[model samples]
Target chain A: MTKKTKWFANGYLTLVFVLLYVPIFYLIMYSFSTGKTMSHYQGFTWAHYVALFQDARMIQIALDTLLLALLSALIATAIGSLGALGIYATKKRQTRNALLSLNNILMVSPDVIIGASFLIFFTFLGIGLGFGSVLMSHIAFEIPIVVLMVLPRLQEMSTTMIDAAEDLGASSWQVLSRVILPAIIPGILAGYFMAFTYSLDDFAVTFFVTGNGFETLSIEIYARARQGIDLEVNALSGILFVFALLLVVGYYLLTQYTAKRQKAGVKRP
Target chain B: MKRKQVLFEMPYFFWLAFFVIAPILLIAYQSFFNIRGQFTLGNYATYFTSATYLRMTLNSVWYAFLITLFTLLISYPTAYFLHYTKHKQLWLLLIILPTWINLLLKAYAFIGIFSQDGSVNQFLTFIGIGPQQILFTDASFLFVATYIQIPFMILPIFNAIEDLQPSYINASRDLGANNWQTFTRIIFPMTMSGVKAGVQAVFIPSLSLFMLTRLIGGNRVITLGTAIEEHFLVTMNWGMGSTIGVVLIIAMFIIMSLTGEHKKKGRKHND
Candidate 1:
């Protein structure tokens, strides 16, 4: 890390971040523009935000998105932890590899392919198009992400910790509750949060499976974007953008603090 | 040994058998015989024989290939540059910031970027470049998809390159290998797995890209994804869509196996 190389890397990093965020920044900027003629600048006002708040459709869609994310993420997280347990318990290499492969399918498969297949699967099961079906599809995809995040934690988990708890007279459920859950809770939390975020934002499979009547925020965004975007939606997106940024900042600070503490502490083991 | 094998395998295989393999097996069965009304290979035959479906599958494949290439080209440099950064944690966050934003938001953001008087055209005007009002076409669709999926390509590559010991490069250079040769021979080969995984990550979604195609490509892009959507939704033709789904699954399985083989060879070479 010489001075010249340091400067070069830092400069490039700056450019990359700029590219990453510039569009969202522009969207935020346009939210306040008073003129309908889209331009770089205009008289600034909170009129758009005010209008956005009053829009019932946007609010309904946001609620729908939240509801879907909460339900799907909970189910996915439970199944994922269980799947991880089953995976970890399996000692044969071939069996473990096959399970891992199957779990990772959603991460690899093309969304359209999965969506189309799921549609067929559900239709075959005699399920009608509606909320229940949408929930099933969301769970199908969300479970894989949960399995991905939690499985690593399970693998890295100290076997002695679980053994110690069981030796202390904890039953299987008690062991899971008292030690295993606590041990990998951070990873599970991360998985659940990521799942919620994904389910909130997903459009592809949701697009395929969602019934005609129900709409999520992603669907709203799609519909708004398609029918020509309005500044009101721009303002709403800005508000969400700001909220997401704040949450990310908080998480970063929290992680950095823990990392620093971990660096400072004596070895707990 | 037999009992040990059974105990070791039962849970993992059971889950797969019931949850994953069963569904796929069902799909495979249904693909051959229409779910509700008929029983035959007519669905598969129709899709295979249709000139339109063949062209669309190729279009989807090539779209994915080009996107993979573009993502690798841009991401490798960015990741390479970031590898040398001191403030990596924050910088890494920035590299993956697009991923944190909702995918749909990012997709919509591109529309804002490439709209007629969008940011791109506005910048072009300021710089005295070509025509005004540029958006919504095959090119923009590809561009938007690339923009959305670039982070997927960068993360694994960055993480892998970060793990590479600097001593290897220094060793190569000390042995009088030039920078270009050292990078190609030592650096690239060592990092091939990450690159392959990243390429797969970027390419698969891009291959099945339907939302962006419909939105940005104005439904004219006619990808395999769009075709699936059209079949299952508009025309209510599940049989054709299922047939295409089987083809897609087979193609991906082939890619996975080939990559697995490449991975094995790479490991052996290193050994």
Candidate 2:
């Protein structure tokens, strides 16, 4: 490429990054503003943060959101990992392919359709929408993701290890718990984290299933935002944004550490 | 052991049958009926017959198309540059990091930036330009949607570009291929999978943007999602809502089939 083309590419990329991040930085800055509007940046104040903590309902909703995400991720991980293992072990290609395709239905379907269907289904069952339905909906969407994650790891593993374990008279349970589990733990963890974030960021699906007296943080934010913009949300958003960034950074650091250890001729646990 | 393995899968199968298969079937089934449990083709007919619904469908398609186009336009070069950079991982992380934040929060941030007295106007004013109304316009709606979707579009394309073997590029150069030729013949085709995925990721969500349209578009941007929300929430017409839901589902399938990978049948048979 010519020098002008190179300069143009660099400039274009820089501009894209600036556009991507400016609003985020703006939001973070305004979170500390004493004024209520976004136009003027007034003297810095901790009032929004103070109010965010003081709002018991918002705090409760945040906790509820985290708890729901954790529970759904945990359940989805267990079932999905087992499902992947079973599918991997299946002798018939058709059965395995069929199962995989069935799993993709949830993955491929639009979120709104999933949300709407869940809404109609829950109402039809006469189960009043609340935390329970929300959790179920989350798990339903998350399982396919977990399965896809773990399945790849399983496929990458060497079947010879299992055969060798069996030759040594190891039980199936022993082989699974000892060899296979340790090998695919990273994939499982990755799947869990991915599922957790999906649950955290989910609004469209949660919007339909979430009902009277139950609200996730996203739902609450949506409600407040639709009514009018609230500065308190900016404070909470600052915290959430930092929390997500830290999670990604921590995950990256963990992987780097493990990779370094492997490079140093240390065995992966 | 195989029997036990099959047994282990039973719960998942049941879950899929109930949650995944049953719910969608219920929506399809409900689409043909009115609120009073009377069987009718009225809901689908109403959707097909009404100008409002037709317009909404077109709007959804248009928005999805535009957002996808813009996202790819911005993301492709960014991904290509990042692929060649030494700090690829760090830059990629920065790109992916914001996506972890909630979509509502991002939309809220855009609201702050796009508001009448917001930073965009404030900055323009400082530059001697009049403070133009940015929020609630078609421009702001597309801008916010494109902003939210950019990261998603970038990651897939970045992965595809990163996975492209350097040897192919080198070979193209060795074969006297020009820069443009290498890009068009080698890099672009190799990155088609990523393009497909990125398009799917960005386009699908753009079609059904509910909160962004309401908060950012100020309800002026009436897409299919807005229509569905109205039918369910405001109109109390579950049948019509389900009808739209069914249509949306069909549209998704059509998009998938259009972009889906084809199997090489003769090669597989030979193998």
Candidate 3:
């Protein structure tokens, strides 16, 4: 906690950051290394990025990934937020425990098992595994994660705001829209981002649920990876890395800002 | 929101039932059938009797244990750095951005860097040391596993450390507690749940991971996931695949239950 120690902490933090990013930096550098060898930096070129753009299937797969991620996030967020509200509204102890336990199963269980199970489940029920089924399977696993993320904020929400609105002749619907919605918006947004990231990098469940002739970006990456480090895929991955970084950075800032504001309020009072 | 919400969700539930639920149930049912299609534990017996299957299960368990252990070791210092630093806002972006890279890509990147004439070897040769073929070895498999699981360990521990009240640590130190004493007695105990949660988060996924083995382990390291993939995808042996998958699930459930019980006991003792 001294000045010297704080400076030491600076060095420590920098080292941690380097360890985290060196692998990624290595990837980006070698991605443009102008070699079919996939290693050994021969020279520099932008051919990989160009090749990535020209591959017609890359656009389709990108669209598939976005559509799947967005649809899954929307459904999972709805189920999770509503379920959290229901828990808030009812406040039944046994119901709460049961819901939480179920949520944990959905959240923490092995993705491979869940994916495998769903694959078999669909085949047994004669459901055709396709892009649509992939989205649904994504939701089954994701809704619980959303609930876990959002429920704590809902529980902490003050009832006074809702009652205050109702006391002024506002309907229940009006109270929900005018009071509840605004309060939970940040938490809901956080849940949405979590769902989006989870769905974006997802493979296990997607592997199980994805059917004949349908490929998302991750699955396509898997097929390419089997052959070797194709530089074009590296460029594509770099782009995804940037996008996910933005979402995570946004989530971290919003959460920290809220926490800091709360601490400031506590100090004042 | 409503327009898209209802259009997407109504049929989606039905879609989940057929795709997600039914396949899981079918896998469960397959574990009980015989060649005659009569109900029995025949599949389970066949799987258990095969020594190769037993060894594969053990391999999966041991490999996952190593990944979780090593991931925690690497992540602890990183998580500790995040905990004590003020620049956590930017530092976390560095830590988490790599996690977004496709797992396969990371595995491939390792191959790119560690292959016989790869980057690491070339760099080593630039120094005094001779070249070593570290790729496709057990060490590489361990590296790949740890790399994938580190984020899981880091996030849970970091969250716990963030939520930690500074007052308790300060109070303990004020009472003449040394650095080690304060950390072990106060900090570690409080973060025990986070550590446990971290273990579960990393352990479960690492336990079931087969794809990394496939891509990077190069057909040498066989985990339960690889076995299941083979049974289901390669041989079309649904019955055997379900049996293996079921056993893996049961083992995971037991491990999770034990962790849950330990945490409850810890909380009770604290109370």
Candidate 4:
């Protein structure tokens, strides 16, 4: 809190931030380098970016990865929100605790265990390891997080509103759609965003479930990285970094807006 | 309303059974069979009896401990200091943003930075140490793993620090405790839960960072994850993979119990 301590604190934080961001910027910086390797400082060129744009397989895989993230996050959000509601509605504390523990299994298990077990499960069920398996695995892993995110919001909601809706002759469906859904929308949105990021960033689970022909961006990056540095992959990373920045900024703005609106609502009352 | 709620919850229950419970059960069952599809306990037998498997498990646990320890060391102070900074939320967001970038990319970045002529080596050479092998070493692997896990450790600790009541600190000061004494006696104990949570988050994943073992460790550092990947994907030995998978699960449960939250029944006064 003193001047010297404040300076020390600022310096330490600056060091940590530098350590965190250097790798990312280093990766992106090389994408524009004409050199094939990251060792030397070659002059800047747009060749890697141009190459990235032209790589049909990479572009296809990128689009597929995006599609997979969107679809899995959507499905997971729906199922997980319902699961939270169900758990909330349960009358028995033992059943509720049981449900909560069951929900956390996926969240706690290491990726290798989840991936290996899911692979065995799919093989036993005769489901091919490809897009379907990958999507299913993503959704499976994502559901728990969605439930975690939404359950707190559900707990925070007052029961009086639902009772009033029921007393005013609103049907169950109408009460859910008109009252509960609107109230819990922020949590649902947060869950969806978290799920989307998880799906997008997942490598280990996707690596196990993906068959020979299918690949996500993470898998692709892993493969190319093992083969040593590929500037094209670097180019793709640069673009993805920017895309991720945009997504984070957008999410931050959304959360800020909702928070402000909630404050205003409270003030008005 | 109850019927409708059940109708909506059907998919969730189905997911719980099929994906969550069933996969675990299936993996445990699959551990009994060999690659030939014959029923046997040979997989577990091999894992238990083989010296290689035992050593690998030990090494895996050792590396994970180191990673967790180093991550905790760096993150605790970072989180503690970060709590006192202005615009702390924004700073926290900056810490989290790096995590959103694909982890593989971050690892790949290290592959470049630690390479023969990479930045670190370049720096070393400039200082006349003249470019030694920086990549594919245990130190490099540990460094990168800790770097990746730092944010995770910081977040929970930061939250815990935020939750600490200011009155307690003031009370401790009023009772004539110095800063170090106050921190050691009060601040650290209260934030123990966050440290436990951070350890759980970092340690489990560190055990299975197979890709990091490959990409950065140059396949020199083999963890349980690397072994699982090799068995399931490379060797096509599903039985062995499942066996290792089961061991990993048990290890996870052991850790969970060790760090498991004990209900704060009543506040204890140290005075």
Candidate 1 residues lying further than 4 Å off, grouped into runs, are A1-11, A165-169, A253-266, B1-19, B33-36, B125-133, B262-271
* Model 4 native-contact share: 0.87
Please give the lDDT score at residue B260 for candidate 2: 61
Error of 4 at B243 (Å): 1.0
Winner by lDDT between candidate 4 and candidate 2:
4
Best-fitting candidate, measured by DockQ?
A: 4
Q: How close to the true structure is residue A148 of candidate 4, measured as C-alpha lDDT?
A: 98
- Candidate 3 lDDT over B83-161, as tens digits, reads 7776675766667777877776777777777888887898889896978978778788998789877877888889888
**Model 4: what TM-score?**
0.98
Could you tell me how far off, in angstroms, the CA of residue A143 lies in candidate 4 after the best superposition? Answer: 0.4
Candidate 3, residue A20: Cα displacement in angstroms equals: 2.1
lDDT of each structure?
0.77, 0.87, 0.77, 0.93
DockQ of 2: 0.74
Evaluate model 4: give its lDDT: 0.93
> DockQ for each of the predicted structures, in order?
0.42, 0.74, 0.42, 0.88
Off by over 4 Å in 4: B263-271
Q: Say what the RMSD of model 2 is.
A: 2.1
lDDT of 4 by residue, B132-188 (tens): 887899999999999999999999999999999999999999999998999999999
Winning candidate number (lDDT) = 4
Clashes by residue pair, model 2: none
How good is the docking of model 3, by CAPRI class? Answer: acceptable
